[model samples]
Target: MVIATMFDHRVADGYSANMFVSSWADITRSQPPSFLPSFRRSVLNARRPTIYTPSTANMFISLSKLPLIQVDQKNEPNLDQDSLRSRIYYIKGDQLKKLQLLASENGCQRSKLESFTSFLWKITAKYMEDSGYLDHVCNIAVAVDGRRRLSEGEGVEKEDLMAAHFGNVLSIPFGRIHSKDLKDMPLTSVAKEVNKLLKTAANKDHFLDLIDWVEDQRPKPLMSRPFAGTEKAVSIMVSSGQRFSIMDKMDFGWGKLVFGSCYAPAARRDYYVMTMSSPVKTDDWIVYMHLPKKHLNYMETHASHLFKPLTTDYLKLYD
Candidate 1:
């Protein structure tokens, strides 16, 4: 069985949507949900006196100041949404293991997601270099869920409460490097950069501070900081869906759920990459990409060994 949901990004992010789907599955199976959804507004209320960190403010830009930002000076125009495209690919488990090993070489430990993000960042930089946009900044962002972090040190009950907390509890932390710098860095070093960026927003204090920051910015629209800056910048959002467990647990007595993935609209302008576990292959990954046509073509031509188009053959559905 295959199930899918189309949602509005303005209203909710992927994490919230994933929770909804998982909860639905739990109800269907007559089992309690692992992460229950909590709707209490006080759950994320701003702290007393509303103290926040400057770093929290750095993650987002106020809409009022957005018009003054400069466009890429290299004469590269903003990407046309019409040129955006989506592709689905599967990465073999062995390939991911090898990437992790390479990224962790020389006494540096890195997660598979971090390793993959570094590789993609490098590929993007390479594309920029080939296109004569070496001066443009390459921005890579990861969406970090803050529920557990917010509940940290509060006891298992609190943690469970947070795990079930519904709505958007996400922070997008990004690292920006000049294309030339990214092009010159080793894969391990790039992975280190990714880890460093993620560490900034993956903590309890960060989320609490973010809540306060949002309280301070109320009534003024805001957006992820990376998206608001340089016109010449190339930015991509990488979200991890490994925790979703959709394929294995989403079965509601309808046999096993197979071939589940996200579908980003082709007309959306931002670049996005999501990594989900393979339904049939335990160690493998199903990568969903929404990026520029040229960028996708570049990856397909240059990194064919690492990224293979997802097909029925890989799923072994045909007898």
Candidate 2:
């Protein structure tokens, strides 16, 4: 589930309607010429032509930690102004292994991808318990990129190159993992359930069907994103293949970026996670997440040992 803290109703209102419309308009306007060189070079250097390998240059693993229990009225973090703070935890090595074991027991592959994610949800549940926020329901919205599936080709060239050609092709699938179930079940069980749900929705046809379904439900035509009051549940959106190769190409004659990450504002209290290529290191990914403050605090206290600080130097958000 995506969870964001808004300082006032006005900010939330602005984000819910106006900002989205403006952002959408800007996105529809035109593709900047600055991106052309990168796209052309990438396409031209295609040796295998069927498979595109993600850069493994400067990979760094980091974790986001949040509190397990809900923060009550008295314990809630200060939000007097319009600024709010939240955190996301990262898991690695042994903790990741444990998650893999859990996933294996739950009938899912013990791959790094599956294990790491299972651990996050497990920790999210723990945070809810520790912070007294277990009563609410949480949803995990997996944002699938539809370009490869929607494209008209049948090779890796289409998949790898399309992201550069098509700007923001995406589909949000609601992985509605309830808070109660997440709290009660073991990590393994939760992994199984999550794996099942994700598998069912991870299909080209499923995306096409979703498109048709959304088109059919017009009048109040809405984009398939979480936190749209579409489900009244906590949901998160996860995007993979952190399009970093294009970053080097995005230079306007300025020095290359040491690192970069996607930032999500606290508009919806529902959780949001974006997995992008780690600019500092290629083999690693930088996951930008915005979740509840209570959960953030819990991870800090309990899972402090797992994550590296998201210092400005590492993310290059500054300079």
Candidate 3:
């Protein structure tokens, strides 16, 4: 059996999906959910005297202000709307360790997310190079959930049921590098750049600015950097699922959930990557990627070992 859910991205970001499911499960069992959700926007209000950090201002303004990029006909993917696709890939703990070791050897201390982002960024830039778009930009948007950051700053303790705090509390900070530089730069260096971009939004002020910035764009749409670029441009976003409570944690009293993943809507032109822990093997991860077929084909052809395809046998669904 399979279950699917749909939520308005503007209203509920990825993290909210878990709470929504858990709440439904609680009702089914005739038990009150551990905590209810709060949809208060004022909780994220900016300081009384409006202050703008340059970085925060740039992040919120540049994307919305930039003109939409246009791609010529030759660079377009050779696929009709119906032919768009998505794939599931798995990465072992050992593989991640190897990459980490490689980074350390190069005098870099990179986390799993940074390492993967750097590696994928290089791979994507390679595709651009191969397609004769060496000067084109390749950006990686890292999705950061602001719930923990906001709560901690607001003096909300760990034991506090933040289940009540709900809305689109998310900040997307991304890194952009042209294909030419990505090709010439080392993996560690590229990852370092990506790490730096992510750090810019890892604070209380940035999120508060994000909230106020959204308010400023009231009647207008907030277009992220990825969405502002052209179809040919490589704009991939990775939403970290390092702490997603799935599997045994999602038990609705019937039994533990055997497996879980995302449900992508119709056609998506840009790339999106998400990762979760492996239930069977500790330290391993299951990656879900939705991207252009050409990019997937290139990765599958060149780096197949790094991304294992999911199968019923591997997951032991029937066992």
Winner by TM-score:
1
Residue 143: error of model 3 in Å?
0.4
Candidate 1 clashing pairs, residues 3+ apart or interchain: 36-164, 72-231, 72-232
Error of 2 at 7 (Å): 22
Tens digits of per-residue lDDT, candidate 3, 70-186, equal: 656676654333544688877888998877665553455788888888888888888778756656778888988877766664454531434356668788887877887787788
State the TM-score for model 1.
0.93
Candidate 1 or 3, higher TM-score? 1
**Candidate 1 overall lDDT versus native:** 0.86
Better of 1 and 2 by lDDT: 1
Model 2 earns a TM-score of 0.61
Clashing pairs in 3: 38-164
What is the per-residue lDDT of model 2 for residues 1-319, given as tens digits with 9 covering 90 to 100? 1212333331222112223332333344543342321123233222232331121111111112112444456654332223335443333346545556756863446665555566667677666555565455565555555555754455776664654442233455445566667877776676666666566556665555554443333334243333543332445555553433433333323445454444555555446565555555545445566765565566667767555456765555654
Q: Give all candidates' CA lDDT scores.
A: 0.86, 0.48, 0.73
Which has the higher lDDT value, candidate number 2 or candidate number 3? 3
Better of 1 and 3 by lDDT: 1
TM-score to native of every candidate shown: 0.93, 0.61, 0.89
* Candidate 1 lDDT, 237-275, residue by residue in tens: 999999886777776667678668898865677889999
Which residue ranges in model 2 land beyond 4 Å of their true spot? Answer: 1-83, 86-102, 105-108, 152-168, 223-233, 246-250, 266-270, 312-319
